[model samples]
Target: MLFVTIDRKSSVSLTQQIYDQIRKSILNRDLEEGERLASSRGLSAAIGVSRNVVLEAYERLIAEGYLEVRSKSGTFVAKGSFLPAKGKTSEYEKVMPNVADRKPIIDFRGSHPAMDQFPRKKWGQLTRDICYEAPDHIFGYAEPGGIRELRVTLAKYLQRVRSVHCHPEQIMITTGATQALRLITEMLIKARTGISVEDPVTDEMRNIFFSAGAGIIPVPVDENGIIPECLPKEEGTGFVFVIPSHQFPMGGILSIQRRVQLIQYARELNNYIVEDDYDSEFTYEGAPVPSIQGLDPERVIYVGTFSKILSPALRMGFVVLPTHLIETFRRLKWFHDRHTSSIDQLVLSRFIEEGYLDRHIRKMRRIYRKRREVLETAVRASFKNAKIIGRAAGMHLVVDIPDIDFDDALAGEIEKQGVRIYPVEHFAMNKGRHTHQVVMGYGSLTPEQILQGVTQLKKFLSTRG
Candidate 1:
């Protein structure tokens, strides 16, 4: 007879509880192979439960090969069901450090948009409308490049907003900019050739290329983005990856002179220029700069995403490939995941066609601009010597506090004081140059949170000083 106990108050069903205990006993070898189990009726009475519960449990166990039923005989433990228990502590658990349970009161990490402001109601309505009225073929596997409607809409929108020159047929939709980068890496990076990227770039960007078994030639960056003059003169370079619209961490706009130089260098090397037009939608100051791809579409591969504009949860982005790379990219994208969500692509197409995307960008620009102002004001007031770097664009600004090395230890200490800040040094490939600076993002924080978080940061720094 098997002894089983059931807690009537547990959220788990009685059937599951009975099934779990019997399975555990069999795996632990408490019930040896060929050992007979009590009849469903007898076990039901013994455990004071309905006979149906036991029968269901037994059926599940038998179906899973844990218990077998012989003709005219009772249920018996399966011959090969025994599995010895391993030690509780795993090898991974033994080596890895424990993560802290407490979350920072205010996190200043960049690249996150205001998720709370996501137009959920409108999005939901659009989704519902798309599902109801969209043709049945949309539910099936779509073109590996993307749906025709979305690519067409994006071609016009990119041309209008960012001055990108592209045909709808050349556009390939990706899960996000990350996927676009991965696919591009696969297509471009050869065994001998490597990529030339901005030094002090986002760590994620560096990791993507590095993980792809491609070498990275670190080109130094300044307040005006990648120094084109310092670009490697070698012939073994595959492509130059740059966030021209707004550089990460340092937050610089690549100057036109530098942009032209970058294009010429790529042409000289006979390589492509991977231009990541990240967060170009919200510029607080002068007119938005035109994309480098517009200057030389043949040599420049343009990558754009809706993650920063709307919500990262959407996982929607696109890449404009040069004419020659389109077919190869399509094959690569097909093998990667066949395609991104078709209904999502349709919904986004409608969103752009209906002009909701433009309106949302305008609204978020105002909100984010106000938050940026609040952050700048608070930081200036709190720390008189703090110098804000970068162009007056994007969601983040770099704060240069002289005489302070914003390394991991100091950042960790500040986190303990209920605030979190990212050190620019952490993003650097060459290190030590940006030890005095930190990147503070106001995209996800409200004006109130920005003000309070900066105040707390200043207070913590004062105590440390």
Candidate 2:
């Protein structure tokens, strides 16, 4: 006999609950096609409900095609029924469209990681271990600054790899780098200040500061990153958001001299700098650049993310705040979101402490290097006229296609050829300047896909001309 429990306290009536459960079973194939259900009297006795209630529930299920009543036989599931697979929707869909149906043949879009390479098996094992071993308190609401163990582990990891100067007390776990930036934009960088941003910067980063009520001051970037000499000398500049390890869209590292120059300018102006070290772990050109935070820990708020190293769906990122900003940042996070998931933080703590995070990053570094090399070689072979920049370190590099307009129309036409690529100017606030450049991100693509995407790109460029 199938078991069915009734919630007497629920607002839902017993008849409706019975109907719902039966219908759900039919659709889920738990009651397969032609599987007979219990008779009304039997169901009523089993559920301790009136026979009339069971009759009504069966009648409803039968009327909906979830159950079919035979002439002499009792109820049975219909031959065909509807069931939504997984029935899940992403929070990102609220901001973007439902593009699942029309996935691009080869996506060259930026800011993605090699998701296929993620160690989901090891992560699953670690998660299960934490679920059984962690204290009961870890399942409840936690400190807005994140679980202490994760923060401690992150502090040690950042210091070892990025050369960031930070104590565990100053680290706050966030959903990702965006949340970290959003907090800094709203709290430390109020609307009254000028936000010095890189020209041809990503739209998402630009929007964060703009939404926080700050005016953007565009600083020009070259192969070496934001020109420190170009930084505004005017007062009221509160913060500078930079991806110095490997810039976005442009993909360049800030030189040591420029790092010093920018730090000195911030010191003189009494401002803050938010260093988004989002992809420093994938650096292939020798040792990665030491973080600017190491240069001036008191002035730089170092932010990093597992989205690139682990999985984007994990939504785990952290910021190492300056001593003066730690309290204020934590308070702001409390008001915004009490905290990130405590269980996730706990599991991540164990993952890092057990050396999985380090091992995984090391493995990915090699994989990403191979992907980058494949992309670089394919692009060079296919587009001889184009120039590649910012290949020193990062998941992506810029391909400058001179003497042509890489505008929206060109992009649309390229898409019509079944190749999805974005012009670098598409991400820039100062758009016209980078019109000839396009960003090719290889992190999320396989070597075959990388070659295929560039081949399609070459076809369109050659034929279009």
- Among these predictions, the greatest TM-score belongs to 1
Per-residue lDDT of model 1, residues 56-123, tens digit only? 99999999999899999978998899997786989898887667855647989797899999999999
Measured against the true structure, the TM-scores of the candidates, in listed sequence, are: 0.92, 0.81
| lDDT, each prediction | 0.92, 0.85
* Candidate 2 per-residue lDDT over residues 249-353, each given as its tens digit: 788889999999888988998888888898888888788889999999998988899898888899988999889888999999999889999888888888888
Instruction: Show pairs that collide, candidate 2.
Output: none
Candidate with top lDDT is 1
Query: How does model 1 score by TM-score?
Result: 0.92
Clashes of each: 0, 0
**Runs in model 1 lying further than 4 Å from the true structure:** 1-17, 24-36, 46-53, 68-73, 76-83, 92-100
Error of 2 at 217 (Å): 1.1
